[model samples]
Target: MDRANIIHDLLDWIETHLDQPLLLDNVAAKSGYSKWHLQRMFRSTTGHALGSYIRERRLSQAAQALRSTPRSILDIALQFHFDSQPSFSRAFKKQFGKTPAVYRRTPAQGMTEASPQSSAQQPNYHNESPNLHLLYNGKCTDGKCTQWMGQR
Candidate 1:
């Protein structure tokens, strides 16, 4: 694939796996490229480092979830692979200039709510699935666990 196609595929993969614990190695493996090469190409094509792109995307998704879902801030933070609520809040404020709670209370004008069909299309993490594993403190715990994991 060409550079643009590769980058597009990488982005799609990132979007599909946002709810999971994404790591550079995993992304590289999925893309069939070495980590260093993928990082360089991703940065050149997207004008952001691979890690930054992932972080920004996660924050964007978290922002959307904050506006659309009734889930708690900490739950949302953990769902997005953030280490803690404070760290998530710091990053959210840095990106959106408001905390998650404030954003949930008074979302910006352009914030769009996901339609029922779109929401229904999302994967249900609570469902029993062997391929999906919940990680806590770097260890895969029970499938039903929702404890905090370290940074992605």
Candidate 2:
């Protein structure tokens, strides 16, 4: 097909096969484009370049491992085909602000928290006028903005 379609297919293939080593030649052959040509097109169209996209995808997987899996950093790195934990950590930090361990410390990290079950629990939305939108700087219950609107 076209160049963009080829690259998108290649990216999808790479993401689906993240646990394996993704080599340039292998990718080139898969997309029926030579290494140099595909690399150039991939860099231009995606704005990320091939290597960055793979590393970013790996880092995202590593982050999920940090959150959901009991595997250690080294184990996760090895699983993602990174040579060492340090390399994985460096790449992870580059992609996301925090290190894997820091992101995993959920209660202390505050990355996730209890959800607000209803509109009453949140100060941003109101219960009485359900589904209403308000832009008040002060507490919303006062109806001060409504009064101001009426006067004008």
Best lDDT goes to which candidate?
Answer: 1
Clashes of each: 0, 0
The C-alpha lDDT values of all candidates are 0.65, 0.57
User: Can you write out model 1's per-residue Cα lDDT over 1-152, one digit (the tens) per residue?
Assistant: 57766766676577778889999999999999999998987776654578966776677778778877899999999999999999999988886667889878984565333211133333221111112221211111232112322232
Ten residues in sequence with the least summed lDDT for candidate 1:
125-134
lDDT of 2 by residue, 1-152 (tens): 55555655675577567789888898888878888887887776554467765665566666667777788889989999998888877776665556778766744352321111133532211101112111211121221122111110
Which sections of candidate 1 miss by over 4 Å? 110-152
lDDT of 2: 0.57
The 10 consecutive residues of candidate 2 with the worst lDDT sum are 143-152
Model 1 TM-score on a 0 to 1 scale = 0.71
Q: Which candidate is the best by TM-score?
A: 1
